[model samples]
Target: MSLKSIAAKLFAGVIYKKTQKWATNPVETQQRVFEGLIRKAATTSFGNDHNFGSIKNHSDFVSRVPIRDYEALKPYVDQVIKGDENILWPGKPLYFAKTSGTTSGAKYIPLTKESMPYHIEAARDAILHYIHETGNADFADGKMIFLQGSPELEEKNGIKLGRLSGIVAHFVPAYLQRNRLPSLKTNCIEDWETKVDAIVEETIDQDMTVISGIPSWVQMYFEKLKARSGKTVGNLFPNFNLFIYGGVNYEPYRAMFEKLIGRKVDSIELFPASEGFFAYQDSQKDKGMLLLLNSGIFYEFVKADEFFSENPKRYTIGEVELGVNYALIISTNAGLWAYNIGDTVQFTSLKPYRVIVSGRIKHFISAFGEHVIGKEVEQALRDAMEDSDAVVTEFTVAPQINPSADLPYHEWLIEFEQEPNDLAAFSNAIDASMRKQNVYYDDLITGKVLRKLVVTPVPKGGFERYMKAVGKLGGQNKLPRLSNDRTIADQL
Candidate 1:
């Protein structure tokens, strides 16, 4: 083994032990994080406005601060944008993670110096944990590619602004810098298609052992590699064993990935966002990611079923229950107070505070009162795929409220790498899985309020073309798994 691989294995042990200290005492660790966040930001303008000074406990804090999405928090964010110090956090933010917003044009999520390290640390520890568990740190000695956004940043009001992935590129640990691939110039290319081509050209023959990115984008790179080299990914990069992904569930893409790579490889799922690094898959054997309670963020959860009701009760880490979907709200050292990042999660393991991202709070189908969520749809499709030979590249679900010949139903727009032999049977299988999981959908189908879901086949590359047309071709952008309306469905 190389010296770096030896050091990585040794370091992984140390990090794993440190993580256990907090992971074992989830409630106490979260309490410390909560108190620290409130105490540190108590003098900021937001704190003063919200009576943060007199907040003695979680109850007091809850009564004083209401959960605010980006739109509600914009006034304070505007002040920060105009170079106002002490408006949100104590002073200026280190950088703004620019992200696409629906109602708002672009959201600038603040990344402060205090909170930035945790993001880097969470990602690093995820890998180290894998190394420690499997005793396979040899990937550290080979080239690794993190397919991501441009490292280039634009200066705004003395603060740098760019995609979160782009901003993080500047902070790659010096030790791994030499192993990271896709030259900076190639990464800076504006177009994703062109960038992937460039990346393929650059790393087609390199000793690639680890690859990381959103699965869809990584699939694109893999497809291009297969076309150019005429070899499966595993054959091309024999050392490649670890695949790291986030932003979307990988189960839907697993079959396609296995076919492309020609083998099964170990993978890690990360729950990261511009707001904060919330969790990472701590064990390959476990079902969910371990929530980072000691990170510089205080978490709150509101039951998803009651989230839209007036004054939904928010539960802290100590109060959440397993298997209940909850809208994740957070307050952080980055100065977001009681901010709803619009994600829903369910606790899979309360003993260690592990969670799975269930869905987006707004991204669901409930046109006919059948509130089908992302997790359900993804799970239903995955179950169907497991029972068949369908190789789906991408898919999305939207309610079809009106039809020319039949009762309204759910429309599944799917792009397939390889189609199933019997499309009707496959669709029935998906519908059956969905009905089993969601009682509302089952009732709707039985009562003839809504018909069984219809699978509308999208031509290969159709979704990619749609994304390019919408000017959100790549780099951390994820297609919503399901939507209430036919906006995406009609376009597809």
Candidate 2:
């Protein structure tokens, strides 16, 4: 690490210690930090004084602002990308983070210099704490690994410059590149699929220092591991370091991952988005961590309440009692006031602000009264595969709609890396896991309402239908995981 980079890390650590202490004092103490950002944003050129909502100074604002989905913010992002000088804060717009939504086309979210610090700082703090908690002087002692993200930046002219991924690739120390995701042979120029394949091949022989990426993509590579080695973690990549991943719940992937590697996958739950760097893992073994970006936004928590409450406004982080489930809403340093990305979570601790992801509001199923959530369903799938040493290469779950029957149910279509005997046992284990891991599904099973779940295997690359449908047939592209409808189920 450069003296400058080391100093950057230390500064972030100092900020974290202060924030961690503040988290312990009660949510009220955070009012100053959270309110400070809102006020700072207001005074900036982006605030549009005539349009500042529900807030004058930080104190003048409501405890929480109404949460809005990305569709609601499309106009603002569109304006900024179109060079609406007045829409942006008083700074050179760094670049826009590209994001996609189910209903909306690509969203280009403008990120300003002021908000960029929060993203950079959160990333720096997470690494420092991971090193501290794991006592892994690896970065300090030697090489480190990072599952590199996209390698290029999108430009309006034929080519502009590095996008976020290309920038990260550039920032990495030269020494680390020799070691970065050792399996990936290509340099930055390789496209996503080629890079992913090289990464998969490399893991077989090398000692992975650190690993990162979305859980779904990570699992896809695990199949390659199975094909080349025909061995578990002990047989290949035994000297592997910790795995830092997010973008989706890791709980569902636990069983297959553990079985394939036969090792503990130390995780750093990351809440990174193209829009912003939201949160990171504070401890090596912890499931969740303190969100240090409070300086970047006003945080809101929407508790699970009666559907369509007479008072439409939901709970705030201030009013949240510990152990309550809430979806996060944020007003960013970029001048996005009150945005909700549809993620649901539960507070595990008040101090240090620990949380466990519940599921997405749009990503669940209530048919058959299963109320099966994306995270829970994922967990059940993993647990079911625990005892069976099946080599599953790809899989997708969808809610089964039985028009003639009274209720819907869950179904999984999987493509295996290696076939397994005892199909009955495998299917049974999956059933038991679903009923045991998910209470909602268990209730339905007990009531004899939902159909007995079933697992069917497809040929290799069978799940590619959705990928082709979306024109992202290879590489970083994947089918929408854990869908609520039969569009996915019927495809099988």
TM-score for each candidate, following the candidate numbering: 0.99, 0.81
Where does candidate 1 stray beyond 4 Å?
Answer: none
Question: Model 1's lDDT to the true fold?
Answer: 0.94
List CA RMSD, all candidates.
0.7, 4.5
Task: Name the candidate that leads on TM-score.
Answer: 1
Writing each residue's lDDT as its tens digit, candidate 1 over 48-125 gives 999888998999998999999999999999999999999889999999999998788899999999999999999999
Worst 10 residues of 2 by lDDT: 156-165
Which residue pairs of candidate 2 clash? 153-163, 183-202, 233-261, 252-378
Model 2 TM = 0.81
| lDDT score for candidate 2 against the true structure | 0.62
> Which lDDT values do the candidates have, in the order given?
0.94, 0.62
